[model samples]
Target chain A: MSDSPDSAKKKILLIDDEPFITSLMAMNLEDSGRYEVREQNDSLKALETIMDFVPDLVVLDVMMPDLDGADIIYRLKNDARLKHIAVVFHTATVREAELHAHGGIISGFPFLAKPATTDQMIEFIEKHLPK
Target chain B: MNSVPPDSPPPAQSTLQQLEEGGALSQFASSIAHEVCNPLSQIVLATDLLAGPQPMTDEFRKKIITFLRQGADRIEKAMKSMLQTCAPIETSMVAEDANVLIETALASLTVDASVRVEKHFASDLSSILIDKKHMTEAVAAIFANALDAMQPSGGTLTITTYAKVFTSSEREGWQRQSWFRAGDHAVVIEIADTGHGIHKSQMPLIFEAFYTTKVAGKGAGLGLTVAKKVVDLHHGRLEIDNRPEGGVLAVLTLKSAAKPATFLSQPLP
Candidate 1:
């Protein structure tokens, strides 16, 4: 999959309002060594970071202080360049039952619950990584 | 030294109690400030400690993580409650069974082991149109009050619901019970507790905004007020009163769904 030097590790962008959640998740993702993760504690700055970093996958929080995960997804879906980038919603607000009710995904993006085990996150990360 | 008469009544007061329209905002901010900040502090402390880790066992790590999550959940609760007090943003209503709602509300509660809930739901009870989340919070407010009151004594909490056809005379019993139109059918729910009842003097003030008998931090005194507003939004009536013998009883009556009480052919949730 990695035909180029820069596309070696999967690039990840984590957006959440809570510093603890973003900071801890970033540390955990980077520690896995398969991901190059960048954390944004403010949801408002998501667009700027996404433009600059151009992540392969985005992990967004559903309920945030400024803009929610759905808002970010809308932005991603509209842009021509970013529309194809994979997205996974990570939230405590929306439950698995609710997710399934909406057809196993939110706006065509897979989701993982907050407080997910590191293993569970790893599996999700791997499934969405570029092949 | 001036010795006032022990039995002398207090100074004259206004008969009509008026809560300043904006009083709740300051009180809400005051309470929520602590609620949000404390959790943030815990998360910060735990993350800082867990950082530059030098020898932390899995158990310790789990304990810290638990604290962080719990704090986050508490912050969510406080903010949610505060938001509910403001006004309804958008209410998504659907036909839902009251029994299910009661169960959802009870499940939402973090009741102590000492508290127990007993349900007596009429099998033929009709469904009601409600926004699931808002209704759950409204019902859970009463359930939580009962739990908080009975936590020390470990008493039984009884919840009962039934379909009631309102007669004109019965409608007269409740002032402005228009939520259930006269001669229309409605769903009635009663939640009662074996805990000590509210004081006779305090009963009148119980639902007043920011009026609470609980010490600071235990509650913001907005539960009943928010519950009342949500019930009103649903075109329902909310009542809180003392039981004849002992305890507190909260009754909620809502307009039943248009359809008659019948199970779905395929059983939908």
Candidate 2:
């Protein structure tokens, strides 16, 4: 019943408190023609949006107002229906040097420092998205 | 009973050394990098889209250009705020009306229309010795923080100024310094906002450099730190606490230049 990989655009949901970052990243990913992108600017509503969108992967920001990336991940992992979705942190809270020192993993999740190019984002998505 | 000998020299650790040892400097550096990176991320993505092979419409091109400019402006703003927070502030002290300074600070900001400003100034308020420009900046910073908290769904901002004689009990609550005494006359400026109050856990960290509860790219998180520095330069006390009903209350107390008997005899009505 599943669509073929070539026919289906990969769904990627980006959750960041900054509208500018989310809007820019969404445009960049959509322009590639290989992915479908949705952005959630409010961390509090991120969980509900993620469940509704049913994205293949979620790119999250670490620091937000009410809810943070870690908290969202915790919620996702706790949910039986949502735990299977792939997740990665894209945050400015940690320095690039710190990410490198930690071998690109933070709190047991794949991580990307901010100021990353669209190419870097696509590369990370391709490497992590489940087949 | 255990204390350094009265004749003993103070510890040799400089403020910079202490900051470095405590990892404050590293934290400060990381915060600055974080602030810059948020805008830099947008810039990178915007430029990449512009350079990509995909056909771009005129509307999309204009949007990308706007974002590029916004990102650059954010970076410039962050750099300027950081410099203002860290640089040594030169102050020229003069006797000025607290009400005038508050009004001047308010005039500098473009406040939202939804937010109502209520001023309750004392008619017999005493004049305070302060650097008018620096004090205005300090007051404006506090006002800015209040306004930020009440954004989108605006609220009330209440400002009150009065003269007082610091009692022993009140002096104990403020910073312990030789410059201010229990009987000293002072002018008090209280700015209260009707917005979501700060969490109890965050109370201690609110004054720390680069500590902010706001979303990234909105601010550099140096407003309170700079405000505190300005108050310190004037040998004054600044205190912030959550209000009982709701929101936050910031109090700025400065030594008054007017005679205590004159100002205190006629209390604020």
Candidate 3:
């Protein structure tokens, strides 16, 4: 039997402090069959997980304990090995209307406001995924 | 002829009042929105999974239902906390021992065994006019915050009560705050904790509703807000500052119901 083109799924890493959120999101994305999802609930260990997983894309929550999304982005951008991976912020820190007004981009980075529909998240992920 | 109404406040005062009210309303609304978003996100995601095209096992179904319930419960809890904090307090003031109130507050909480509590109540401490129930809640809130700061590393929680007569110099130092007058006898209750002190930048917003350093689900961020409100209703002053020797100290000063004796003459319990 020959392998299908869709069988090679894109790898996505989700970093959020909320366990339920990461769990539900991973399940939903993996169910779609277009992606393989990994969840990291600890923001402190996010970098280590990213390095080991080497996911194609990373979705992070903005407000986290110890280290925040921006701090992680700074570290990622500074590190040559991790700089090339795509990053998107999934946050509840900003209002959904504000996110929309900014065209889903905050501080020169892609953003998806919390309570977003699965379609919206998938669309955002697809749009921001590295080509 | 004057165009402004005779009973109206001065233009500058009115403007300042407006600004203060507007700022409070804005902060409250923003806090509610932000706090609700986390639970809402969970609900949306959970529902999305339930409606997904994937085959659902019995385990997955049970998990999703649990997630939905958890999310709903969180939202309900946050709303209840917000309402309780924002509600207008109806206080019945009476002369009560400050130490008793602190004890009452402490008794209500389940203080961890790792945290040691020390009380240094003044033998000559005067009773203060307070709504006992509300004041106890305020003190408990402060205690809770102190404990939270210590977290996994428990520390000593020191509570001290003393009485003082505010002198003209002290009044001037406080910028003639309406809460106290010169020569007024006041009882001071200090709740100090040997925990990581709050950051200087965050001190201004600490009392603001839903402004918390704790991770989501750990708090609704209304504890200090409610505490401050209760103190304000009693015309008392509540000040929280980082102690020099480490940790944070919360000083609550309320008007003494009776003439306070010379605290220097009394022995500490």
Q: Report the Cα RMSD per candidate.
A: 21.3, 7.1, 7.5
- Candidate 1 on B118-177: residue-level lDDT in tens? 889888877787778878998998888888878676988999999888775344222354
For DockQ, candidate 1 versus 3, the one ahead is 3
Which predicted model would earn the best DockQ? 2
Give one digit per residue, the lDDT tens place, for model 1 in A1-131. Answer: 12334467789998876666666666666655667888887677998899889998888876453455766777877799788888888765453333443343454677775556555777998887777
Ranking by TM-score: 3, 2, 1
Docking class of 1: incorrect
Q: Per-residue lDDT tens digits of candidate 3, residues B16-58? A: 2322664676657777877788889999999998887777889
| Candidate 2: count of backbone clashes, pairs at least 3 residues apart or interchain | 0
Candidate 3's C-alpha runs over 4 A off are A1-7, A78-81, A95-106, B1-22, B169-179, B261-269
Q: What value does DockQ give for candidate 1?
A: 0.02
- TM-score of the candidate numbered 3? 0.83
Interface RMSD of each: 10.7, 1.8, 2.0
Calculate model 1's interface RMSD in Å.
10.7
DockQ of candidate 3 relative to the true structure: 0.57
Q: Rank the candidates by DockQ, best first.
A: 2, 3, 1
Name the docking class for model 2. medium
User: Residue A129 error for model 2, in Å?
Assistant: 2.3
DockQ of each: 0.02, 0.64, 0.57
Alpha carbon lDDT of residue B91, candidate 3? 63
